[model samples]
Target chain A: MPENKDYLNYIDRTAPKSPLLKNALLAFLIGGLICVIGQLIGDFYQKICGLETDSMRTAVSVTMVFLGALLTGLDLYPKIAKHAGAGTIVPITGFANAITSPAMEFKREGLVLGMSAKMFVVAGPVLVYGISSSVVVGIIYFLYKVLIGG
Target chain B: MATRLGNQTIALDKSVSIINTATVVGTKESEGPLSPFFDVKMKDAEWGEETWEKTESKMQKEAAKLAIQKSGKTADDIDCAFAGDLLNQCISSGFSARELGIPYYGLYGACSTMIESLSLGALAIDGGGMDTALAVASSHFCTAERQYRNPLEYGGQRPPTAQWTVTGAAAAVLENGGAGPYVTHVTSGKVVDFGVIDQNNMGGAMAPAAIDTLCAHFSDTGRSPESYDLILTGDLGRIGREIVINMMNSSGYNMNDNYGDSGCMIYDIEKQDVHAGGSGCGCIAVTACGYIFRQLKDGKLNNVLILGTGALLSPTSSLQGESVPGIAHAITLSNKPGGEG
Candidate 1:
């Protein structure tokens, strides 16, 4: 029987047709909306409370994280994530959802080992790489300053 | 009574029946569509275990015990237990065996362990090595994540293509000369690699192997998709399901109506956050034990083909940039007394 066929050829011929443009557009709009919400929160804190820019940024982030966690607990974020795709995942809200969702899932395990331990499952890599990369960049800057006598 | 139709297909000499089955799943799986069908839904994922790994062992033990109980047999009645899980050194199944107190055959077929164990158990009975045997497989999402992907504290962002590891265990008792769904035939699969290196998209990696096995089974048995009431793939999820369907169609067999995936059946993809669907040893194990076996027992389905697919890649292999190899094992079940189609 004719059992021999190029495997790569078969894969290309049979793969699902993805709606690349439409998906990208949805992701863009939803991601932009999340950013807009963050900006609005920042403005509210700055203008209404007379907070400094740095403080306002911090306040906005904290509020967004809280909102993300709350929505996740309510079982509402997944619905939005279904539609928004990467839009909901690219923002700070996604980070918040990452930590909150797993923590909520493992809560039945226990507080210390379950919730507190798994709380980093999604966010721990970000912290590790993020901090380590910054340190490396900081060292480079220090080297440049010392060498150039700036 | 026995026949080797082809290189991979084996027809059992004696009709081996799946006499009983049990499923135990975590809270997330309990919230899924097959929740009510499961034998035990743990109120807590931990089951009072100090760690997630131990919890997985407990789940496996409970599932095996429940199946043995349902079979109306004691642990001594089981000649041997064939089991495996997605944990280092197969600790979950090993620990489970310590509890079941049955002679054990620890297997590792990744997500395909469920069907692999079932096939082996059926073979053992047909070979007259045992009157009754137990087949069990398990996986826990937390433990699997920590072992296979990342630690609980890593807090990684899951790609849309990634699938949620099912937290559950399933056990089936295969007893010769019993009345239940009879295992008639099995098609052991060969490892096939299409050079897909992406770990996040396991379904893609395994789809080609599923296609290979399905095609081989059909050609070997001289049967088509219409011959079976249902043709189920273990954990192909949504993406791999499509790919396999397309591959099948191009290969001159259209399985559009009969084919489905256990991964896609476990949860509502739209309502639930599981991106690609459920994937793990437990995914197919629970689905078959909870849903498909019931249908078979009720005579809703007389003939069905279960193709258990697995991605055979370790974290080390993945990190070393090795391509994921995929394998599938197919078992045919019929409710008829003589294994009649």
Candidate 2:
């Protein structure tokens, strides 16, 4: 074993020297491209299906999630995510990939333990917290509407 | 005179030669820089096996058998086999050993198993315990990922600092005399920990140990950086390689042009998308066997130093918040007369 100080020094020196500016630029480009694709899909849905605003929004979300899963299944999302970093991961497609990736991986383990149970390993927390917080917010909105006679 | 030079190094009185080598890699590894040098590249992940673990065992078996055959020797010619892998109980090596039917020493040095086996194999031969020995190490991406990190289906995002575990196996035959690169010296390393708990950044955890072994080798042998044509670190990746260079520079050994890391050199990082680079017991094993062995045989490189570094952290150890301790063992392979290059 080396002296504590010497080991610490080497560890410090060896820490990753990430290119922050370059990564941020790539993230911005990729994230923006993903958002652009989402908007384009939403526009296509509105023009083609003639759905109302809220329904169109839901359609777009579903479409994006489907695309995310499709890309992830093809193993293309990870490749994109490798370069795009958080850009691809922060979008609806990222969530789709999160759910789809585990499901595909665990499919070999069988549905009960592998697919069904492990599918939510990455996105489960996000889904839980996001839905719970939305429910609480919905309750507050309902109470406000009832009391204020709006 | 005692071959023991300094605290960690031993200068072998009898030369131990690398008789032959064989390397087998998975599809992903076949896309790397050293792919052309591998003996066999499997097109399928399953490799006709039902499971990834079985496939890894198959790889080990094929590599060991192929190496012995390439050396113009049968399995009966190999006195013992030193083999290991990342799997629990080293089942990959054990299962392969059952097939090879040779006396086996199942070693575990994490990613450093290649050099560990080589060091032991050479020592056994040099010490007159064995005339011919085989050393091998293997790792599979799927098997290692499920055991150490997450299931393949978990779809967890790998941080940029995380390295991709190699799916490959490499085997070498070391004997008393052969027309090949010879093992001349070895520096066994001591375990050192810098208290790095993040398993993703293995290169950081292992840098100190590599430096310790390298420095000790130099001090004990009274040899400088200029002695070797290349100073190779096994599976240190990009980050740890830089740290090693910086430490060596500060210590007054300027190893600028002749330094290489097997982990980083195996893949073209930008082209391959292997972020930090390749790792595993197979990383060094394959590179040393395929690339270094070829270069030395062709006399492109006269003398080389190989340091295999391993981050000793199990799944339980990481979860328990134990810092990753690391170790690195070094061996000198040279092409000079009487193996003194």
Model 1 / residue B3 / CA error / Å: 1.9
CA deviation > 4 Å runs, candidate 2: A1-62, A127-150, B1-3, B27-36, B44-46, B145-164, B177-180, B336-341
CAPRI-style quality class for the chain A–B interface of candidate 1: incorrect
Candidate of highest DockQ: 2
lDDT of 1 by residue, B1-341 (tens): 56897889998878799999999999989999989889899888688987788899999999999999999999999999999998889999999899888999999999999999999999889888799999999999888986777444322346666899999999999999888689999999999888877788888889988999998999888889999999999999988998898779988998899999999999888788788899999999999989999999998988999999999999899989888899999999999744554
lDDT of 2 by residue, B119-214 (tens): 999999988989999999999999999788765643344666788898999999999877658888989999988777778888878988999999
Candidate 2 TM-score restricted to chain A = 0.86
**Residues A34-91, model 1: lDDT tens digits:** 8999999888999999999999988999999998888878877776776677888788
The top-ranked prediction according to TM-score is 2
lDDT of 2 by residue, A14-114 (tens): 56556778778988999899999988888888888788889989999999999999988888888788678778888999899888987887777788987
